[model samples]
Target chain A: MQKLGDFKLPQFFNYPPYFTLQPVRETREKQVQLWKELILEYCRTQKIFVIGLEEEFPLFSNPEIERSLSHEAREAFVSALVSDGRAEWLDKGHRKCLILWHRIQDWAEIIINFVKENGLEDSVMTVEEIRSGIESRGTELHGLDRIILMRALKLLEHKGKLAIFKGTTADDEGVKFSI
Target chain B: MKEQLATFRSQLEEFARKHRNDIRKNPAFRSQFHEMCAKVGVDPLASNKGLWAELLGIGDFYYELGVQIVEICLATRPHNGGLINLQELCNLLRQKRKHDREAVSEDDCLRAISKLKVMGSGFEVITAGKKKLVRSVPTELKKDHNEILELAQAQGFVAVDEVERRLSWTLGRAIDALDTLLDEGLAMIDDGHEDGKRRYWFPCVSSISSVGADS
Candidate 1:
């Protein structure tokens, strides 16, 4: 019943061993799987795009249980998600990770559908606008991370579904949708 | 004091030379004495003051043997020839409330036998029913047939089994006396191999004889 910023945490989040990396292979596999699901679910709901292994991540510890995952345990869980292609290491140092709760391909498809439904198939919008503008306000695209929005735009661009161009401030990128 | 010391030394030297001649001549008693010392793990003639003191501490070995002989004699009843093994003899001696009572086991017998071997005197274990029994028949009673014999100028035949019954001592003491007697060459043994018949005799001691007839 634990909720963090409107993201409901699973009942096992209170389990102390859930924070500690289990040593036994079978138990650890289940433990890692549960962590993977919880991480993805939390990121998807909270629109969290990046997780820094060395930095504090609210999902890694539960104050109620006074339990926290060690750095090794955090890396193990993240590495499991990375190996499954559900997440990717954002840097070679593996300190930062980009969670793909919805894959780039899935996000590209959603973008295409959103454009068609909005009747803006050939429309142009700034990258930042797509992330937080009025058109995306009620959708999963609203208030999303710019890096993730860029990755999803790039996926669409590769399929000739859209074109990305740099704008004036480096904060604004132009996305022209062919769909 | 010097003149008195010289006199005492001469007397001691003279006595030593006389006993030395007798000790060298009597090989059997010498060997028995040597064997007993060896059995007790003592060096007999080692002039090392402490060793000699320890050996002398035993106090008159032959006298102790004689007392042992008498004790074993009275300990066994006439009937049973109550078979006392080495362990039992040691226990009885140990329980006498004299000296530090060291319990002797079968290993002590082995060590004693090793000493006997060193002294050129040793014992043979008796055999019963084709089995070499652990029971050792002393040399004195080596010729004893375990037969019921008449005591010296006595009335009735001495029953071997009754000796076992009458002796208040443990059965182990009787066997040890028989062992001592066997060692002293007083008893004869049949080894239980001839004609499946059991017999005992005294070849040297006339005091122990058949009750009625010569046979």
Candidate 2:
């Protein structure tokens, strides 16, 4: 029943060892698998793109249990996600993690679906507008990371589904969809 | 007398060969057949090289079920710490084999588990209080540990005082058993409760499994 701002946490979140990394190989592997799943799910729903190792992220600590994950445990978990291609460490010291709940390939699919649904195909949209414009206000593309969005756009452009045009500023960069 | 026994065995084997499909398809029929075999002291599933085995092919069936049992045990070992309730194991086996025509009874599961003894000392069916538990790990659980686990079955957890008061044991005996289970990774500690007493939770015998397994 525990919730982090309407994000329901799993029952095992209250388990003390969930904070302390397990030493047993089998137990630790399951624990890590569960943590990876919960992290990705929470991020996907909350639209969280980044996690700071040193910061007081809500999921990293449980006030009800008075237990918090140690720095080592945090690094170990996000490092696990990084190796799985679900996340990436932004710095050398592993201080920050960029969570890719949806892989880039999946993002491309979402983009195409969004264009088709919005009847925006064969039309033009600026790069920044797609990120925060009224059309994308309630969609996943809204508030999306610029790097991931651009990568998806570049991927689509390479496939001849769209064309990218230069603009006076990065925000004004335009994309014309041929699909 | 020996000649008469031989005749009976051959006749029973012939009957089993005829009803092999019924034995494989019906859980109730299979249990009754196994019970009947037990009464006559006829080893219908003991060996795979005999005319009886070839006639029924039930030996391979049991072996296949044994492998599935091992896989289920290993997959759930982390959650239950290598121990699982017998009925629960059977339920999971049935779920895993849902596509098959046969409904797997607990008796069938027990027979399959017996066939798995050759794997090692790791597979065992031990009685914890009144409940039967299948222990997949080679970890030796003493009588006190079994009693502790039995106590934990009620609430999925036990505190030192609860163990001492319920089992009428001194504090030393309870702590020793709890500590052993904790060392085995069979139990987890919870010290965050409002009462401040450390509650030892046994996941193996506990009825409640974790949620959020949804994709």
CAPRI verdict (incorrect, acceptable, medium, high) for model 2? acceptable
Cα lDDT tens digits, model 2, A25-79, are 6667777888998899999998989899999888898888787788988888899
**Candidate 1: true interface contacts recovered:** 0.00
DockQ of each: 0.00, 0.27
Candidate 2 Cα outliers beyond 4 Å, as residue runs: A1-29, A50-98, A102-127, A133-142, A146-179, B208-215
Candidate 2 overall lDDT versus native: 0.83
lDDT by residue (tens digit), candidate 2, B68-103: 888888777776678888887887787778898778
Q: Where is the poorest 10-residue window by lDDT in model 1 chain B?
A: B206-215
Q: How well is each residue in A1-179 modelled by candidate 1, as lDDT tens digits?
A: 67887787775575444565654454456568778988998888777889999998998778886667778889999999999888989899999999989887888888887898899899999998888889987988887777778888888888898899888888888988887
TM-score of 1: 0.44
**Most lDDT-accurate candidate:** 2
Q: Model-by-model lDDT, in order?
A: 0.56, 0.83
Clashing residue pairs in all predictions, respectively, total 46, 0
